[model samples]
Target: MTTLNACFRGQLGDFQLDFEFSIPSRGVTALFGPSGCGKTTLLRCIAGLNFLPEGKLEVDGEIWQNGKQFMPTHKRPIGYVFQEPGLFAHLNVKRNLTYGRRRAGIKSSNDNELHELTGLLGIDHLLERDIHALSGGEKQRVAIARALLMKPRLLLMDEPLSALDQDNKNEILPYLEQLHSHLEIPVIYVTHDRREVERLADHLLLLKEGSIIAKGEIGELLTRPDLPFGRAQDAVTVLDGQVRHYDARYGLSTLQIEGGTLEVPDQLGPTGVYKRLRIASTDVSLSHQEALNTTILNRLPAVIWKILPTDGPSLNILLRIGNMGEGSPLLASVTRKSVEQMALKEGQQVYAQIKGASLLGSSSTTQPRAHCMTPLIACE
Candidate 1:
């Protein structure tokens, strides 16, 4: 497998940043952490926007940065889309996108490629409009178009959606997913938003105080007890399954994951539509006895594994799925009172109630995976 590995160590004003990670030569590599966690600073260093003391950046065997022989930002081939859509107010949308076309090293512009990008981003009608006249979402789309139009070897995005509100983020997610599905170019996305990382990153780089804390696929890290951040938020177990059967009339999709069959919302088209479903631990419920008449469609029998105390007024229990293959696990968080009331214990049998619609993602590709399940786990 082609790998893009980077090793660097630098001190930025009292902050010493040291990050070393090797991501697959393709797909999104998400840099995730809390606010003021040096996610952006590291991204800048990689982009040559911020010069580090002793840094090295390599992509698919091409050296972009080293200790003293660092390549200038203008000289290196990188397409950067900043946090705020940094469009030129004086230029129109079309001009902003085509600006990089005239830059050195860019061979030529194909009218068809430009038209396709405009169409894909839903900016064909706004090409003639001024930058200031566009909405935040539109501006971001244009900025992304500009970056892709340059045909850089790698794409860098630093919290591209943070400036926008929730509605705007939703408006742009489909476009971002389309870009990932269609293009083969590698992307390094920096964000504090767990949802964004969960939906987009093929590899997860956990940063804390300007250093890497943990690095792995999204799925593996979510249930991992080693990392504090992965368990901080409501833990969502991502599952990749083929749309075994989609009953359009009933509005449900039967998915096969690992050794079990699951039912989720019928959002996919045909059979080949790979799906990444998120089942939050909170949404899952455990029953000590057999559930014969439960309304929940998914009630797979599970064996109790590790039951631990959560920081909140809850208990996080690790479950070994029955008939879903040995050792493969699922997570459930329930109240301590409920656990004691039911006398939940290890080696006990229980049914895991999973909702069909609780599964999130339009087939999340970048996030973590159990068996490298189509490489969906820690995503962009």
Candidate 2:
């Protein structure tokens, strides 16, 4: 598999940022960390905004920087979307969207691409409106359409939804999902929000003060007992499943996964469609044996993989869904007293109980796996 390899050593005043890593060349790669974890700085380095003389970056085969050779910001094929939609205040939405395409020397006859992008972003209706008259969500959609018109090899988004209110953010998330689904170019997204990563990212990279602490697929990273994310209080695991049965009268749908079926509330999509569901660690509970007269609707047999302690008195239990190592794992958080009461240990068989309402389903797409032999290069 092709990969994006990067190595950088720089300084922002007294803070030092030094790291080397490689991620898959396709799909969304989320850079997740706290406020001061250098997520934005690294993104700038990739965009050629914060030029690092010693930085090294290779995207799919082309080298953007190596030793003294550096590509200027304007010459690189990149599209950037910031938190605020920096649309031209004096121009209509149509003019603002076409500005980048014209500057990139694209032919004016490529109206089909423009129409498709505007329709996908749901901004075709706002093309006649002035930029100052649009709402926050509409403005952001226009910005995204403008970025896509450039036909870039790489896309960089820095918290594009952070400035909007919850309602506005919800309005724009589905369009972003659709855009991600149709694009072929790789994207590097920077955010501290775990929900966004779960919703969109194919790969997850956890950053600390200035270095990467862990990196892997979204599903594998979430259930890892040795990682900080697995020990987090709000940790969650995402599973890919297909809709098996839907009862219209009772407003319930059943999804078939690797091990068993999950019954959720009201999945409107077709029965054969693929869907992804997220379950929080706190929303799941484990039982020593299957019990009768339970309110929980979903329960699957699993084997205990490992037990990890949290910051407080809770324990994060990692349970493998099936007998194979490639099967998905489930995470459940319980108090230490419950561990003693149930005698839970590694290799013990148990049932994972989950509430129907707690399983939040979302539309998701898959990508090819990254090969384990992908080269890794480091520089000082």
Q: Each model's TM-score?
A: 0.88, 0.91
Q: How much lDDT does each candidate structure score?
A: 0.76, 0.81
lDDT string for model 1 (1-380, tens) is: 54466776768788888777777756787899999888988888878888874778776677777677788888767789998998999999998988878755566546788999888888999999998899899999999999998887889998999999999999888788767766667788999888887777667789999888887777666666666633443766766666778787889888776657787765574675666667788878988665778778888888887786667888787777774326346778888899999999987878888754354545334322322312211211
Error of 1 at 153 (Å): 1.8
lDDT of 2: 0.81
- Give me the displacement of residue 199 in model 2, in angstroms: 1.9
Q: What number of backbone clashes does candidate 2 have, counting pairs of residues 3 or more apart or in separate chains? A: 0
Give stretches of model 2 more than 4 Å off: 244-252, 292-295, 323-326, 357-375
Model 2, position 102: C-alpha lDDT score = 77
